[model samples]
Target: MVTMTSPAETAPTPRLLALRDAVREIERHAADRGWDGEVTASVFALVRTTDALSATPDLAGELPETALAEAASDPEHLTSIEQDGLPEATTLEELLAQLAWPEQVDGAAVVVERLMVPPEAEQGLPQDPEEAMAALMAHPDRTDVRLAAGVLRTGESWCAVRSRSHDTDDEVAGSPEAVPGLVEALRATFR
Candidate 1:
């Protein structure tokens, strides 16, 4: 008897490979920057049907103040994309549940979260996380707190670190992991 395996069983699809590669690069960067601690990464895919990734401005790109509300699918926050807000997340599951992805998705991104101070390490940690994050962002000393990565429909790839003080052009020793959780997350969605 002859047997044959499906495309997925035999080898990864193009989209899968793209996501894996993007995640790998991001993780490598994280590891190099020493940001790969016990932080739970909440991964999401902005999947699309085409080969190009959409650069369309969406609420997800907003800063935390507005981002938190928009991500929760609040209508009041739906006014515009110029607002910058970061979503509030205590748990990966909670973050995943609250995400407001576009109706059309074509790519995947991983969000690795880190606190300015560890829960146990916080001697005077701010009760509100937004305050802590804002404080970190406002410091005169700039640090790269890199966070996310993506493969767009344009076939363009990007890895992002959530540092207000740093630019994407700022080069660092990138040494992301061979595979990050984003791959599994995207696969779970499409498969």
Candidate 2:
């Protein structure tokens, strides 16, 4: 008579092994890049999983339980694995067959873009006036809209400074003294 093995006794599947390898590759890349800051942090926030087998709670685990537990509890490991970049394969079939999942890859791209690119107003602003405005407006907790408004206000003040300096022949348009007042004004608005 033939006997059937229980699910618990079954060997790990090839797909699962591939997935584990992909995760490991991502973690290695993240470590190499020193990606422990805002970008990786955001990626961790987005793709974090509660699965017992997928989490990386420990730095090194000799047993399955310890490894699984380590993965689950360690946000840094999970974030690094989820956010690391992947190379683009030639074909969709090749890509699909090679990686964990397309959704995970796409999510990582979104996190990278959001972290790397400054918002619209901050992009292509003039070096002296615009950069000064951006510096004046930046805040740790402010929303993008609020920050943009601050940028606009600072830009207007810079324009005024430029006009006044031109009229007076004082060259105060790009002077260091102008930045403090604008920065103070921006800080006051937040209050």
Candidate 3:
């Protein structure tokens, strides 16, 4: 599933490279903590700029995308949670844990990881990417089936696709910008 691009075309800028490193760091942390889940469900977001969003620290590291979206839907919820009180933010993870992202995604770094299942394979596909992967691996007919995913965040989603059964090693997938009508599609899925 790796996208074959010219070396010149695939060269990452310094910022993007740094972002990639951050994604790796976070992922390694996740793995160490046994946060084994679908890449998407385990999505993390951060502020692209160093500007602080709130009184909290400038960085919002390794947060669930669903939590980010839910908190954005209502500010009062965050206020109420704050009033209730939680752990003090002494580290970036704690900071992210304590804060609720408002209805603003501008300049936010999103890292998504999801399993891509084919229509034919949908019957067995599970909502959890890890489970889906395990099922896919066990299945006999594993061809042309891949997990289309967005692994890291660097303006565009950083792709890391791997084969379902044969090749366990992750391949360097292509860089694709946000897709048009994706929001609508997601909404429809929820409905």
Cα TM-score per model:
0.35, 0.21, 0.37
Each prediction's whole-model lDDT (CA): 0.43, 0.30, 0.37
Off by over 4 Å in 2: 1-8, 42-191
When summed lDDT is taken over every stretch of 10 residues in candidate 2, the lowest stretch is 145-154
How far out, in Å, is residue 54 in model 2?
29
| lDDT per residue as tens, model 3, 7-59 | 77867554444344443344344434332244322333443332232545433
Q: Provide the lDDT at 62 for model 2.
A: 36
Each prediction's total of clashing residue pairs, residues at least 3 apart in sequence or on different chains, is: 28, 7, 2
Candidate 3 stretches with Cα past 4 Å from truth are 1-5, 8-10, 33-40, 52-138, 142-155, 162-191
lDDT of 1: 0.43
> TM-score of the candidate numbered 1?
0.35
Question: Looking at candidate 2, what is the lDDT of residue 29?
Answer: 36
lDDT for predicted candidate 2 compared with the true structure: 0.30
Error of 2 at 86 (Å): 16
Clashes of 2: 7
Worst 10 residues of 1 by lDDT: 75-84
The weakest ten consecutive residues by lDDT in model 3 span: 75-84
